[model samples]
Target chain A: MQAYANPTRFNALALTILPWCVGSTVLLFLVGLYYSLVVAPQDYQQGETVRIMFIHVPAAWMAMATYTVMALASAVAIIWRHPLADVAAKTAAPIGACFTFLALVTGSLWGKPMWGTWWVWDARLTSVFVLFLLYLGYIAIWQAIEEPAKAARLAAIVALVGFVNIPIIKYSVDWWNSLHQPASVFRMDGPAIHSSILIPLLIMALAYTMLFLTLHLIAMRTEIMRRRIHNMEQAEVQG
Target chain B: MSFTAPHIGFVLASYGLSALVLVGLTLAIVWQARSTMTRLKDLEGRAAKRRKPAKQVKPQ
Candidate 1:
């Protein structure tokens, strides 16, 4: 990890790992989709609509997970002063936001048929919505602030503070009477879901995770290149 | 699952929306990365050319 603090090393590492990540993402997604649409049994309650779980659930999981990744990188930027930390945090915001947006959209599509509504103000739904807003707010801070250091600090604070909502999003269904279903796959005891459904869901989650990793690496590399260009331009002027 | 099953439209919409968004995000990120890499390389090449002429004119 420390070795990657150098931009050159980080770039080389990202280049090496990127193809593998992309390849595995393709393979996992194919297998997961096969199981999701073909092997997983339809729910007695929701029927074919349950297939949407393969998409919605993984998206929701990634939305939360990517924010956590961002917050962690932000913390490193603040506490450890890891040079790549800020870039990691900065690059992650838009991707995380995209995933959160997808989660909301896909969740809505799932909700419309299962819950008889296109939207709801339930605890889980509302909390996840707040998370989406936080992502936007974090990204806005970066864009709004002209100073890089200041923007990094402000974005880090927003990310750390916004992390409080993650737990709320996770427990919202349990804490309040809500339209959203309680934990089935992630629980204290264990996943109550049948193996056929659970397997595909986990595979889909892996695929999403791989996708996130691939995008994140590319983004970090891009950020590094952008900074280099800025520095070089400044040098040309000063020289 | 089955197209004959109930609420199949919702299932399709969810998957379709997810696919669309994920693919779009991937393309956007990849494009940005490639653009940045290209710009950096271009800037480096220009800087190198500028340095070469200066070195030639110098005492060394």
Candidate 2:
């Protein structure tokens, strides 16, 4: 990990790994989609609406997972001043924001039929909403500041501070009465769901994880290139 | 998979929107990568050209 603190080494490593990530993402998505749409059985109670679970659950998971990645990267940036750490954190925000948005929208779509309403200000929903705002706020800090170092520092602080919400989002359903369902997949007793449903759900989750990885690497490479361009421009002006 | 099934719209809409958003995000990142790489290479080429010494003119 420390080896990648050098931007050049990180860029070379990212280039080497990118093709594999893209290939795995595509293969996983194909297999996961097959399992989700065709192989997975419908729920007896929710019927067709349960189909939404494949996308909704994975999106929610990625939303949290990406934010966690961002927070960790931010911590690395602050503690060690790892050069690529801020790049990782900064590149992750928009992707995380997109996942958060997808989760909310898909959850809303799932909710209307299941809960007989479009939305509820329930603990789970509200906490996730706050997370979406945190992503936006962190991204805003980066954009609002002109200096890269200043922006990175401020953004890292925001990410670390906002991370308090992650646990709240995870436990919201259990901590309070939520229209959202409680932990079924990531529980101590192991997934409460049957194999038929759980298999495809897990596959979809893997697919989403690979997708995040692929996107994150690509975004990080772009950021490194962008910074290089910035440095060259400054050099040109000085010279 | 049945179109006539109840609440099917909700399920289809969820998948449709998810596909749209995820694909859009992927495309945007890929496009940015391509553009940034191009710009960086262009700048590097320009810098290299600038650093090259001017050719000596032949004496009249």
Candidate 3:
């Protein structure tokens, strides 16, 4: 990890791995869409409406997963003072925010047909809303401050604090009486969803994950370039 | 697969929105990267010129 802390090594590795990541994302998305639209069995109750879950659920999963990644990266930046850790956390914010927004909008679109309402104050919905706000706030902190170091420190703290909501979002359906359904994929007894639906859902989730990786590497590389430009500017000013 | 379903509008909306957001983001990132790289290269070129011998400076 420390060896890759050097931006040159990180850039080389990211360049090498990014093609595979992008390729897998494209392949999975195509296959997943085919399965989702044509092959997966429609829900008995929800009928064709169940198809929204393919996009909605995966975006929600990525939303929460990206925040967890940001929080962990923030922790590394704080404790280990890893040089690139802050960069990882900072670059992840807009990407995570976009995913969170998609999850909310898509979920709302799914809800209108299923629950007879476009929005709700249920535990699951409310917690996810808070998670969205948290992403916005994190991004706001970065944009609001001119000093990058100060902004990074404050944003890391906000990320760590907001992480308390991640578990709540995951377990809201379980811990409270809510309109949202309980976990169907990751459970002690294994997936409750049928294999036909599960396959496409898993494929879509994999595609989302790959897309995140591909974007993250590009964002990180761009950030490194930005930092280099800043350094060069400072040197010119001094000289 | 058929758009003949009752709630097909919602499906179309969902896919359309996803494509729009993802494509917009990709374009924005690519634009930012290109612009910043150009700026950095221009700055480096200026700095290189400043370090060159005065006699070698091409009159502009």
Each model's DockQ score: 0.89, 0.85, 0.53
Where does candidate 1 stray beyond 4 Å? A165-191, B58-60
Which ten-residue region of model 1 chain A has the weakest summed lDDT?
Answer: A182-191
Local accuracy by lDDT, each model: 0.85, 0.87, 0.83
Looking at model 2, how many pairs of residues clash? 0
TM-score of predicted structure 3: 0.89
- Give candidate 1's iRMS in Å, 1 decimal: 0.9
lDDT (Cα, tens digit) per residue for candidate 1, span A1-239 = 89989999999989999899999999999999999999998887778887887887788788888899999999999999999999999998888888889888887887777767787766567777988999999999999999888999999999998897667665765456435554432211123688877899999999999999999999999999998999999998998
**Between the candidate structures 1 and 3, which one is better when assessed by TM-score?**
1
Model 3 residue runs over 4 Å out of place are A166-192, B54-60
Q: Which pairs of residues clash in candidate 2, taking residues 3 or more apart in a chain or in different chains?
A: none
Q: List interface RMSDs for the candidates, in order.
A: 0.9, 0.7, 1.4
lDDT of 1 by residue, B4-58 (tens): 8878888888888888988999999999988988998899999999889978899
Candidate 2 lDDT score at position A169: 67
